[model samples]
Target: MAITSANQLELLQTAEAVAREKMIDPDLVVQAMEESLARAAKSRYGAEMDIRVSIDRKTGRATFTRVRTVVEDDMVENHLAELTVAQARDYLENPEVGAEIIDEVPPVEMGRIAAQSAKQVILQKVREAERDRQYEEFKDRAGTIINGVVKREEYGNVIVDVGRGEGILRRNEKIGRESYRPNDRIRCYIKDVRREVRGPQIFLSRTDPQFMAELFKMEVPEIYDGIIDIKAVARDPGSRAKIAVISYDGSIDPVGACVGMRGSRVQAVVNELQGEKIDIIPWNDDAPTFLVNALQPAEVSKVVLDEEAERIEVVVPDEQLSLAIGRRGQNVRLASQLTGLDIDILTEAEESERRQKEFAARTSLFMEALDLDEFFAQLLVSEGFTNLEEVAYVEVDELLVIDGVDEDTAGELQARARDYLEAANKKALEEARELGVEDSLVAFDGLTPQMVLALAKDGVKTLEDFATCADWELAGGWTTENGERKKDDGVLEPFDVSLEEAQNLVMTARIMLGWVDPTELEAEAEEEAAEESSEDATEETEA
Candidate 1:
């Protein structure tokens, strides 16, 4: 039995009802049917065959039209075919020999095969419409926090039903050490929303720093109301977190607001994070003090910052070193990331020892070469030359720029400086040799051959030069006419030594060369003094 027109109308109504339930547009379905029919006709019929199909959106009416060309000769059905003059006259009252004719064909009864084809077209259109609707719905929801029910687990990832669509929470994006079960209610931050061929894909993350920030916003009313603003957040999710907050209103304590009364607010966030610790620090413009606070639970005694290197050395107490470093150095590491600094932690004892060693090293170098007092050490510090090596290698003009040092004084200092450096290097070499060290001149790059020759000619070649030369004599006559020390002037200006400097130099050289024993020299002086006293007593007795 053939179906009536009413039956076709009933079928169209049924398809529209299904589309509405599936969130697919009815017009889009009808358009898909028409397009499918045109494709099917082209595939089955020749390309030259002109065919048009249309479907009524409101009514269940479909129509097809076939267009044919009018020509002089009959060659093909649609391309070069033509109707005789009598037939053309019957169709048109007056028709030209070369004119075309378009004839309307009655709608073909959609048989079983054709009906099946139309149904496939309708289903495909409905799916495309649904995908478009989903893409448009979720594209604007990125970065929003949403509550979802666990749908299923796939490849160690949890698929969540977020009302509109399913969002995948990857394993890495899940909070550390936290697990999810099927149908579990969880809140996650929407990390991304992407349009795929099938539909919109939403990505959820519980490990994102913004997740904690949004949680704080929800738990702390002051934040959501805009009285307090969270400036920054850093997390080692499932462990510890640091958040910097500022207040828009001067009267409000941003930290206190986030902490709530008796720690109720922050505790709520902590509970959500499975009891992970949170450090709510107030935002400060002072970098050093701010960093000190950022590395909390381990009090910082001092912070030496290198802005150019984006590095900071933090000094804490000996007892707090482990705390500052945390388990596997996590504390300091996170603090470094939070403050955007490369942090090096040192205990107070370590820092003090370092400073003392540095000071002693500098003092040893300056005292040996420059004939300088403690005042010179203070000057070197002010000039940013904290070590004796710097003083030994730097030019006299550079030293003169230091306050309390003049060109003449710098010249005298420089002249004595080379002698001091040579003595220091000789002492270091001797000590290294005694210790069976292979690299005796490891740090003696500043001791040039000319400097060694100058000190040698002055008799100040060993570590004992200071003991041999009087401070006044060494300081008084060390400069030339131009107030420049005669330092290693190859053949033009050979290094010269004054009588007093030469005497001191000789004593130093004798000690270094092992020609005179230091202990024997002291004993000989005591013996000579006793003999002179005994002789004076004998002369008195004879008289």
Candidate 2:
């Protein structure tokens, strides 16, 4: 087929029109043709074949020129079969051994295969350019929420048509127990956007943590403006969630703002979560207080902190124990996680017992001592001075400083105070030793002989130490090794050192020394002392 200039101009015009319709630059189209023609020439002729295509914008005429190497031998099959130097000189005035000669290969009409190959090349390049453009467009949108229409459902997954491309809402990412029909308009978080072989593949999610955060951002203006911050969040999707919040501005209440008036704001967020309950707890730096608040509807009376064990014992009324513990311990469990502490719930009874123990420990007396009616005795109990030595060490002025005690009483008490204090301390040491209290008297520095003797006379000997001594034995006083009164004098001391005092002193010593503790020792001591005094009075009257 002989190509006329008119035919060539018509082909170029057709190429130009196709390039414009495809939105491909004219220069690029020309470049693509040149590369295609070069490839086609090489395949037909050999690697030695070189070709270039030229398009004239005015006439739209396209032409092809082929260049050949001037070689000495015909050893190369291609490039005009390598013309000899003598033959090459006939065409050129000066010819180098490696120089190439240019020639025009009368435009060979592209065969069907060549035309198809060129068309494929143009299409491939155009498609790649479009993909690059799309990838650049969507890459910036990753991690953002986008509104899209549900285009179709395939195998339980929804394909959303985002304006620029398509996004997949995987079955797992969709809210469970909810259904979406085709063309349903839904908002989803764009987890990722990447270029794939087909086009930009956008991955959308509705269950991501960012989804919850975004909901808060939409519903709470303060959060969007950065006035309030969400400290931490834990969620059981479609069920419940706990979000801790704080504010940079001291005056702002982060929780209240997030909750909104009548909970309208938070309710809106809850609705989006498909009725998932949201707990907006105020973030607290104090772990104990924070945990107390975390377990809502449960009032806490006290919190025993065990920092080393990372555990806390929370005491609530008997009626509130169940509430504090929640359904299957859910309340406490979540509270523990939120506060990063292990929580144990205690009822009122347990708490009372604990308080009694703590009081005994502080007073250095048995819980029984608390029952004592004597003002001075009770004062000693309150001060944790169970034995005479503790009292002896207490300054008279100091005693006077105690609430309800005047200087006159403190002075009078101090006058007869030493003997009583010594006796009380001795009784405490013996009781502590008998009870096998660990480290008993090992660290006690101010014990006196009088206190030890007095403690023994009260039957607070080893036998009485471990077990509660009878009132008669304590009042009558214990026997010495030779069966005589334990006291130096046959007559028991006239001063008032009641059996209750003896008991209280022993218990207090035990506590101060980190020994075993029962209950209010002072109360029981007073009762025993009163009974003994009554019995003694009756015996004297009979005599």
- For model 1, the superposed segments whose C-alpha errors exceed 4 Å read 1-4, 7-12, 43-52, 66-103, 109-113, 364-384, 387-408, 414-543
Per-residue alpha-carbon lDDT of candidate 2 for residues 322-424, written as tens digits (9 for 90 to 100): 8888776767766776676677789989878977776555454322233234554656666756554445557777677678778776665554556554555
Which candidate achieves the best TM-score against the true structure? 1
Count of steric clashes across candidates, in order: 8, 29
- Provide TM-scores for the models: 0.64, 0.50
| TM-score, model 1 to reference | 0.64
Whole-model alpha-carbon lDDT for candidate 1: 0.72
- Worst lDDT run of 10 residues, candidate 2, spans 483-492
- Per-residue lDDT tens digits for candidate 1, residues 1-543, read 123476557646866887788776777776776766654554445455666677666676666667655655454344423565556787788877767677665555555676677678877887888888777887887877999999888888999998867899999988786777899999999999888876778999988989999999999888999888887788888888889898989999998999999999999999888888999988887778889888888889999996634678999999999999999888887787678777889999999999878777776556545556777765676567865556657877788888778877776766676667677667755654554332322223333344444444555444544335553343333234573333222210233333445455546546665768989989998999999999999999998
